[model samples]
Target: LLNSNLTSELLYENFLKTLLYSIISTVPSCVFLFINGTMLFTLRSKPVFRETCRFILLFNLLLGDTLQLAQSQIHFLLSVCRVKMVYSLCIILSMLANLTNLISPLTLVLMPLEQYVAVCYPLRHASIITVRNTAAAVIAVWAVSSLNNLTRVLLFFKFPFEKMELYDLCSNIALILGVMTAEYDRAYTCVLFVSAGLAVIFSYVGVIVAAKSASTDKALARKARHTLLLHLVQLGLSLSSTIYYPLMMSLSKVLTRMVFLWIQNAFYVTFIIFPRCMTSLIYGLRDQTIRPVLLYHLSCRLKVIIRG
Candidate 1:
C-alpha cells in the first residue's frame, strides 16, 4: 500500500511538471509572437497603420491574449507547484481569465465587421470606424466583459468551497471546472459561449454576403474575404477553449487526476498554441508592408551569420 501511494504521488508530480512545461513554453511563445510582430509592424509601417481601425482591433486582441496567458501562467504555477495563492489573488486571476474569455471572441467578431464595412462601404468606412469610435468600441468591449465575469466571480464567492481545505489547491482549469459544477455556473458558461458564437457567426455571414455582392475591386474583395476568413478561424479556435471546459469535466470523471491533467495539457498544446501563432502569422506577419520588413530583417541576419 505504501509503495502504491508513493507511485501515485510520483505520477502526480510528473503530470504537474509536464503541465507546467507545456504551458510555460507554448503560452509564452504565443504571447511573444503577437508582441514582437505587432511591435515590428509598428516600427516598419508608417503612421497610417497605427491609425487604422483594423490595427486597433488587432492590438486589443493581442492585449486580451497577453492577459489571458499571464493569468494562465500564474494559475499553472499555483497548480503545478502547489503554491497557495491568497484567496483574493486567486479570485482576481480567475476574474481576469474570465474577462479574456470574452474579449478574444468579441474582438474577433469586430474584425469581420470592420472588414465588411471596409469592403461594402469603402467611401464611408473611414467615417463609420474612425479611430476615436474604434477606441470607444474597445473600451466598451472591456467594460462589458468585466461586468459579465464580475457576475460570475460574485456568484463564485458565495460558495462554501472557500472554507474547504482544498480551496487553495485548485487553480487554472481545475478551479474553473470546480466552480462551474454549479448550475448557475453552467448557465453562465453556456450564455457566454452561445452569445459570442452567434456574434461571430453573424459578423462572418454579413462579411460573406457583402463580399459576394460588392462591385468593388476584385483584389480588395478578395483581401476582405481572406481577412474575414482569418477572423472566423480565430473565433473557432477561441471557442474551442470554451468547448474544452465541458470536455475536461466529462473526462475527469473517467480518468485519474494525473491523466486528466495531462489530457488538458495536450488540449492546450494543440488548440491554444495554434490560434495564437496563426493569428500573428496570418494577420500580422503576412501583412504586405510587414512581410517586406520581416524579409529584410531575415536577410540581414543571414548575411551576418554567413560572415561569421
Candidate 2:
C-alpha cells in the first residue's frame, strides 16, 4: 500500500513495462519448473531411488516443492498484474498456497531425521526406515500439515467482514484478518519453525558425534555434515521469506516507487526461488547416483529445445 499511488509515475503502467515484468518473472520460473520436473522424474526413474529411504524422502520433498513453485508463480503473477481478486477467490488461492508451502519444512524435518538414522543408527537404518515405514512417515507429514491448514481455515471465518467479495490484493500477509487469527498464526509459525530448527540441529549434532567414532567412515560423516549445513541454510531462507512482505512493506514507506519495485523483484528471487532451487541443485549435482541420471535427462531436454 503506497501513500502516493500516482503522484508521478506508475511502476508498470505501460505495455512494455508489463510485458517486461511478465517475462522476467515467467522465464526463470519456467526453467526451474522444468528442472524440478526432471528431478522428480529422475527420483522415480531409478530402482535405487525407489528402494533407498533417503531418495524416497527426497522425492516426497520434491513433490511438495514442485507444487509450491507452481502455486507461487501464480501468486507472483497476480500481484505483478496488479489484479485485485475478490476476497473469496483470494482466500482460496492464499489457502492453497499456504497448504503447499507448509509441506516443505515439515518434509524437511523428516528428511534430516532419516539422514540422522542413516548416519547415527547405521545398524538399524534398514529395518527402521523400510518402504512401509517411509510411506507412513510421508502420510503423517501430510496429515499434520493438513490439520494445521484446517485450523487456519476455521480461524479465517471468525473474522467479521464488511463484504464477502471485497476486492484486495492477494498475498500471504492478507491471511491475518482478525486479531485472534493473527495471534494464532504467529504462535503456530513460531512453534513450527523453532521445533523444526531444533530437530535439524539435533540431527546435526548427532551426526557430529557419530563422526567422532573410529568405526565411522570419515567420508560419510563429512557428507552428512555438509548436508545438514545445507538444510540449515534452507531453513534460514524459508524463515526469511516469512518476513519478506512485511520487510518490503516497511521499505515502501521510504523508497521511491520505482526503486521499491526493483528491490521487491530481487528480494523475491533471493528469499523464495533460490531456496527452492537449492534443494534440486544440491541433490541433483552433488549426489553421485543422481548426478549422472539427472544430467542425462536434463541433456535430453536441452537437445529437444535445440532441435525445436
Candidate 3:
C-alpha cells in the first residue's frame, strides 16, 4: 500500500512537471505576441512615417504573431483540460500552431531584411520591395507554412497509436505529427530556426554598418540605433524560445533537462510577463508617438473620474 501510494505520488509529480513546463513554454510566447502586436499597430497609426516595405513587413509579422498567440492559447487550454476531442480538431489546431510558428519567424526575418534593403539600396528599394511584391511575399510565406503543416497533419493520421492513453490528446496529435514526419518536420524547423537567426543577425549587422558609414543626420542615426537595439532584444528573446523547442526535443540527459527547464521558465518570464508589465513603460519611456497617445488616453480617463 505504501509503495502504491508512493508510485501514485511520483506519477502525479511527473505529470505536474510536464504540465508546468508546457505552460511555461507556450503561454509567454502568446502574451509577448499580443503585446508586440499592439505596439506595432500603435506605431503604424502614427502619421509621421510613410507606408513602406518595412512597415508592411512589420504588419505581416504582427499578424503572424497574432495567429501564433491564438494557437498557443488553444494549445494551453487543450493541455489543461486534457479533454479528448475529435481527431479533426486535434489536427486542425496542431496544423494552425505549426503554421503560425513557422510564418511568424519567417515574416520577422523579412522585416529587418526589408529595412536593410531600403537603407542600403535606397535607389532600387522602391522597385524591389513595392507593396504588391511585399503582399505576394507575405502570401507565399503563409502558403509554404500552411502546406508544410498540412503535410505533417496528413502524415500523422497514418501513425498507429491505438492503445496509448494520452494525457493530452492534442499533445498526442502533435507528437504523431512530429514522429510521422520527423525527418521533414525536424529539417524544416531547423532550417527556419537557422535561417531566421542568420537573417536577423545579418540584417542588424548591415544596419550597424550602414549607420556607421552613412553621413546621415545625427538624430536619425540615434533613433535608428535605439530602434535596432529594441528589435535585437525582441529578436533574441524570440529566437531563444524558438530554438528551445528543438533543444528540449533533442537532449536526453537529466541535468541538461533540468537546466533547459530553468532556462525555459526564465525565457517565459522575460518575454511574456515582462512585456505586458513593461508595455506602458516602453511607450512612455521610449516611443514618442506612444508617449503622447498614452498621456492623452490617461488624461481623458482622469477627466471622466474627476467629473464623476
Top TM-score model? 2
Q: What is the lDDT of residue 264 in candidate 2?
A: 70
Q: Which stretches of candidate 3 lie over 4 Å from their true place?
A: 1-50, 161-169, 172-174, 178-180, 212-226, 243-308
Candidate 2's residue-wise lDDT over 194-295, tens digit each?
877988999999999999999887888789889988888877777777777677767767997567667877887777777777779888999999999999
TM-score of each model, paired residue for residue: 0.77, 0.91, 0.66
Please write out the lDDT profile of model 3 over residues 9-89, one tens digit for every residue: 998986787687767656666545545655555556665423565556655665665665556555545644456766566
Better of 1 and 2 by TM-score: 2
Question: Alpha-carbon error at 242 in model 1, in Å?
Answer: 1.3
Deviating ranges (above 4 Å) for candidate 1: 1-46, 166-169, 172-214, 294-308
**Candidate 1 displacement at residue 53 in angstroms:** 0.9
lDDT of 1 by residue, 1-308 (tens): 99999999998978767666666555666555545455545543666667877878877887676566555555545554566655556666777777876787777657777877787788999899999999899998898888887777777767676464444434544465344545665676567557656665666566667666647666777777677667767777776666655675687689985677677667655655555555556755668865666567556655776899
**For candidate 1, what is the total of clashing residue pairs?**
0
